[model samples]
Target: MTPFLTAYLQRIGWTQTPDVSLETLRGLHLHHNGAIPFENIDVILPHEIDLSDEGIFQKLVVARRGGYCFEQNGLFERVLKEVGFTVRSLLGRVIIADPPDMPPRTHRILLIQLAGEPWIADVGFGGQSLTAPIRLQEGIEQATPHGLYRLQRNGDDWILQFRHHERWQSMYQFEMGQQYQADFVMGNFHTAHWPTSHFRHHLLMSRHLPDGVKQTLTNFHFTQWQHGQVQESQTFADVAALYEALQTRFGLGVSDARHGFSLQQLEAVMAGFAQHDEKA
Candidate 1:
């Protein structure tokens, strides 16, 4: 195996795999989601989100930091290609978006054709990331370690939904198109710097446990889910508590090199959230 692939395997707590099979894909997806959380700290810090290959590897694997969809799925895509898998870069329009009526394709997803069958894999949808790759079948309720997800047909596009609170909530919509790093670069720029982007407004981090439990932190609100139910939740009273949860709970340590932020800056952002809440 190549050195890059070797280090990536080690980062995700996986030994070397012999081949690119369905079982291997599932195992990698599960392990990757658990170890690397989905977070938007850079967006909140207003730092430049480097989407280059070397940049992503350094920020996520070496620095031990979490990132949003672009970095997370982008890394996964590179890994799968290195492992001899047929991977295609795809984008999705987030359903929960600012312009709720029609949103841009800011979500990065992968489509892999294995054994003559196509499957979707995404390790970066924040609170609702898929823990396993499901086949490209419409109306089939695919079960992951955390929840039941399915894809549906919508006029030439595909909509992904997860069974939340006994309701199939739509996550995003997509139409198969060839996407390159250049495409992601433009999307990442808008997502990171756009004034109205949701990533700028709130702090979001998510990770799933090996035992089918999901933990998500949305600003001060932290929630854990098990068996598709809310297992535990809490609201942090201050930035100190929030910072602690990012390290201890989500495995993201916010030192200068790791997360590129200090506690004082984090406190300032939390104060902004409070002010925004008051105005609402």
Candidate 2:
């Protein structure tokens, strides 16, 4: 057992040995959402990424930092295993807000078996997801703090949905399957290095709140949402202000000259967005 897991468990207030039952799994999911964060600074920095248990343990547990889906779900899987839950890695795609029919398989998530039923447990997705595990059955609405989410069947894949203004919207579709670390390494590299990948062009960070809300920082904008309503939203004027917000609001200790996206570059990027939007 690594000290990372020990420390994480302690931080989550789970001093007792973890149980693999549904109740325990729910508790773990809630704890994860409330404590850990979802971030992509490592991706932006083009940091050496690894999917091994030890690698995830070091990044999330030892460093007391957060990561994107791959890193977050990777570590969460290991923690579940340590706690006696049956977990497996599953590949997923990002369904952008536009193009209602297109889904790109560039993301990773987790499928866990707890209490004899398959549950989708993802601590990696920053926003619009369940903080607790949900059953994989089709058309079954699982009530979560984020919203009432459901798994809808689509051919061989399962589509995750959230109730939005009394209707369901497809979030992402995933298959219950096994994947190895090597499978993710290629995609991770592409996303981190490829010019077209959004992660390469944007600065993103998110942290789950104690009241089931989520705080997100994207480019120069900071937004906090609770139960799907925007609680707070603001924009920074410069990179220095952005960095200050990251450290003060997100609890991140990032140096202005760190390995990831720099303050100047981020400001320029945000300026470009504003320009583009104004043009439109």
Candidate 3:
């Protein structure tokens, strides 16, 4: 194995030999979701979202950092292919906010084929993401560590929904269109550079915690959910506290060397969070 792949395996604490079976796929997916965080600090800081292999390796494995959907799932696609699994890149939209129209295809997911059976695997959706692979069947509830998820057909597309508050809410909608490298490049560009994009302005971070809890850091607010219900919540008093929580609680190993956020930028982001909190 190459050093980058070795470091990636070590980063996820995967000790077993890799195989192209469903068991390995589930194990790697779950381990990755729990190990690496879903963070959009680069977008918030207006940094480069490099999707290349070397870029991903330096940012994720070498630097011990995390990334948003494009970077996270992009690297995962490479790893899955290296392990002999047939993986295809798929795109989806974010509908959790109840937008008036169909949102753009900003979310990246994987469709892996094993023994002629297809499955959905995503570790990049920060809040309430899937922790295990799900079959590509409609109206079938697939159980994960977080909650129950199901996929329903909508014309030529499929809507992914999660059981929330005793109701299945639409998370995203997408067709099984084959995604290319340029497709993700365009999506990443829009998400990372567009002024209207929430990711470009907000700090979003999340990870699966032990005992089947979901922990998320939205701006400076920290929340823990169990079975889709908020179990614990708190807000950091200042940027320092927020940084500490990101390091200790989220395991993001954020630092000046890794993030390269200037003091002015940090203060500005903190101020932005404070303003949002005031409005809330």
For TM-score, the strongest prediction is 3
Q: Candidate 2 lDDT, tens digit per residue, 1-280? A: 5576688797666766677788778777777776666777676555677767777766666555667777777777878888788888898767636555664566787888766778888887776646888888988889875668888887998888888888888777777666777878766777677777777656778877657778887767789988778899988776688777876787663542333356675565566655644455
Model 2 pairs whose backbones collide: none
Clash number for every model? 0, 0, 0
- lDDT of each residue in 84-186, candidate 3, tens digit only: 8999889999998899998789999999899999998898888878898999999999998778999999999989999987899999998898788999999
Model 1: lDDT to the true structure: 0.87
- lDDT per model vs. reference: 0.87, 0.73, 0.85
Q: What is the TM-score of each candidate against the true structure?
A: 0.94, 0.86, 0.95
RMSD over all Cα atoms, model 1: 1.8
- What's the distance in Å from true for residue 20, model 1? 0.7
Question: What tens digits encode model 1's per-residue C-alpha lDDT throughout 31-78?
Answer: 999999999988887688888899998888877788989999999999
TM-score of model number 3: 0.95
Rank ordering of all candidates by lDDT, starting from the highest: 1, 3, 2
Better of 1 and 3 by TM-score: 3
Model 2, position 180, has a per-residue lDDT of: 78
Q: What pairs collide in candidate 1?
A: none
What candidate 1 gets wrong by more than 4 Å, as runs, is 16-18, 97-100, 256-259, 277-280
Error of 1 at 115 (Å): 0.7
* Model 1, C-alpha of 219: deviation from truth (Å): 1.1
